[model samples]
Target: MNFCLPYSATRRVLAAALACAVTLPVAAAFAAQAPAPATLRLDYLHTGNASTEQYAIERVVIEPLPWPGNMARTVDDTDRGVNKVEVVDKASGKLLYSRGFSTVFNEWRSTAEAEKVNRGFEESVRFPKPDHAVTVRILKRDENNAFTLAWSTELDPDAPDVVRKQEPSALRPIPIRVSGPSPDKVDLLILGDGYTAGEMKKFEATARRMADQLFSVSPFRERAGDFNVWALAAPTPESGVSRPSTGVHHASRLGTRYDIFGSERYVLATDNRALRELAQNAPYEFIEIIVNNDTYGGGGIFGQFSTAAANSDWAKYLFIHEFGHHFAGLADEYYTSPAVYQPSGARVEPWEPNATALRDPANVKWKKFVAAGTALPTPWPKAEFEAYSRDIQQQRVALRKAQRPESEMSALFKRELAHEEELFSRAPNRHAVGAFEGANYEATGYYRPQLQCMMFDRSEQFCTVCQDAISTIIDLYSRPAPH
Candidate 1:
């Protein structure tokens, strides 16, 4: 919603470009007949260091579009993320809505920078509009991996401080794929960044291509008809997003950029306010931003959004790999790549469905998928794999250091993937669903469900365990609420 903020120039330009906002035809259909509740958003500032955190309400917004999620699946039963948000009736204490999500702030806290200084991040949680007052609570996992209340605040949707209306957005969403009404299907908003007005057609085409690639993968392939994809972009003057590591910079609309936390390949959009403003114009439950660049970079946060380099040689892999993190909170299974997160002193079982600590191998979370006599700590060509991985990492660093052509980097990765595939093919447990050491950024102590997975490398298909995790989320959005 529009507020008298300090950015008057931005507001003026946006208002001029977006004269009127229109809702999607499918959204309109639900509104005219079996209307869902109005969407309510609670915006806040999450601040802290690695040890301590604080949250303060910034504002409450009534988004223009109705709730795009299924009314029956309001509570998130899949405990995947680092944090959880719960909205409850203030009077009766009945839980009205809940969803598990992770934020850029959470990831930042894990970086070495958090040990030295404090930081703050803007975050928002949306749910069906409530009729009365409600209590909002944020929960974080404790040492035992159980959720404990971290922050709580009372909210009144009808309060005078709430913002209800805004200047219409000039941008409208292009329907890439409309299988059914939004209430009966997953609504995915494909937002584009670093594309100029002249490249609008290119942006739409890229979005369509990526959406098609996503469905071509398993789980999504089987549930293609259960999704509705929409594409939207507010053009920028430039053709590529910021890459500060290479001395490149551009004032993109969504702040999508590379070199986050000093990791050259880590891409993310840090402007929550701008992102929400543009996204509010569409009906969506999920978002994936495709930056108009060929660099190999992208990032994803659960229940937030994902991004990819639309023109990269591995755009299809980047799209689905990052979506696994954003969609199902799947943990990265590979540990060879350079990352920004600080290593933990102890190994606690990860909340992600794909990775585990294997402290109690007998009761492993995915034990159902394990064969009768599969070893608890599945063995692979660990020594050979790690040795080759080290050499590849050195070459990767040298390529970046010398500023080699992206083609060279792509070719190097291709060779590396081929070597891995060949090595794994000879392993005895190649097709087994056993815990393989090396996952969640650690080579030891942590384990993954399978040796080869899209989350692990530049592979095409998700591992068996990952496919099941994804299907659970798909069913949550497409099926009617469990009665």
Candidate 2:
């Protein structure tokens, strides 16, 4: 008894106490923490003309609390938390097929920033019926472990009535070509502007026609099986109202009054406050901006947007041409005319598939096609070619002046001197000569290899250059083979 317990016993007792001291608190901490869970429910509402889908959900997002406010903030902020949620069809449950989206709190308030985010989010969600209805609700997880709904709104999928004014013909699917990368399906989104409103039937017809024309094109024709078209019908004319004859002659420093180029900036979705909202609903690799006006003029910017005058007979051509610009980055081969914006003299290389400065001639992208004898700054054939050259120059001036109706001018040129037929012939001085009538940029001076091409002029076919560009674009956006 006088002898203390052995030193080993004393050391063992201290070690056990220390281990318990560290282990117990960790166990207690884990016991105190809890995992968060979230769930959402969807209900489909089919309104006669339009359908609506509603999503209801309550979610809890736990973030690490900082400093003194951590525990207290978690308790107070529990009421403020929002659930992030999305709803998809039961059959196609992929996120890409989600029809409804909802987010809690104003994470981004800036208009431009919000627009960008909204666009991205919209692109990510694809409703089974884009023209169906949708509704979203955000709720807080209450202390009782129940969803206390805070906000809710139903989205209307305004489906237009397929009113058959006449006997319903067989619904013929429009044929389209596919040459680029192989996609599971072609995602086509057609945006309706003022032109689509009054002429719903015509708009649909034109859309179908365009789809057919697209199928006729190469590469797209090859991949016709993998395409779908979605039209976002807005209440607008397919072509703008014809400007009064008096207004036609009014010229501005910018250009002719008939040059209603800037009208595109004003076109917006009527139902949806923002274009991104509609774009988000149906994400498209190609967006066809159909205007209501008929007086022909359209634009395309690669990887950006393609616009068309809905009413022109050549509307189909404009659609494809601008699409080439928006989708393929093809350049305007005809160059003698002026542009809305002049190059800043900065050493810039165009991003289009056709046309080049030969800045690095040896490594030019289309170098393989340049003939062996073709010289840089290709020589302008001499004065003997002056007649053709003069014709081209005169037409270019007329085009810039917006002096005559395009149809009348084209018809006049076609009848005179057989310019239309000879435009693309491969004579010794063919590519080297004066103006060629059908060239896209110039009325008569520059000659394209083909008499008719989507780029050079409407009422013609797409040339080899345009075809190649279309093929390249199709390839770029297509999904690659899996590794």
The TM-score leader among the candidates is 1
Candidate 1 per-residue lDDT, tens place, 1-483, comes to 322223112323223222234533433324322546678999999999999999999999998767878888889899879999999999999999999999999999999999999999999999999999999999998988899999999999899999998887777788888776677888899999999999999999999999999999998888888888999999998899999989999999889999999999899998998999899887788999999998899999999999999999999999999999999999999998988999987999899999999999999999999999999899899999999999999999999999999999999999999999999999999989999999999999999999899999998999999999998998888863232
The candidate 1 region of ten consecutive residues with least summed lDDT is 2-11
What would the TM-scores of all predictions be?
Answer: 0.94, 0.49
Give me the runs in candidate 1 sitting further than 4 Å from their true place: 1-20, 23-33, 480-483
What Cα-based lDDT does every candidate model obtain?
0.89, 0.40
User: Tens digit of lDDT per residue, candidate 2, span 52-137?
Assistant: 11332222111111011111111111111122223322344332121112221111221223333332111111222222344444
Question: What number of backbone clashes does candidate 2 have, counting pairs of residues 3 or more apart or in separate chains?
Answer: 44
Question: lDDT for model 1, on a 0 to 1 scale?
Answer: 0.89
- Score residue 52 of candidate 2 by CA lDDT: 16
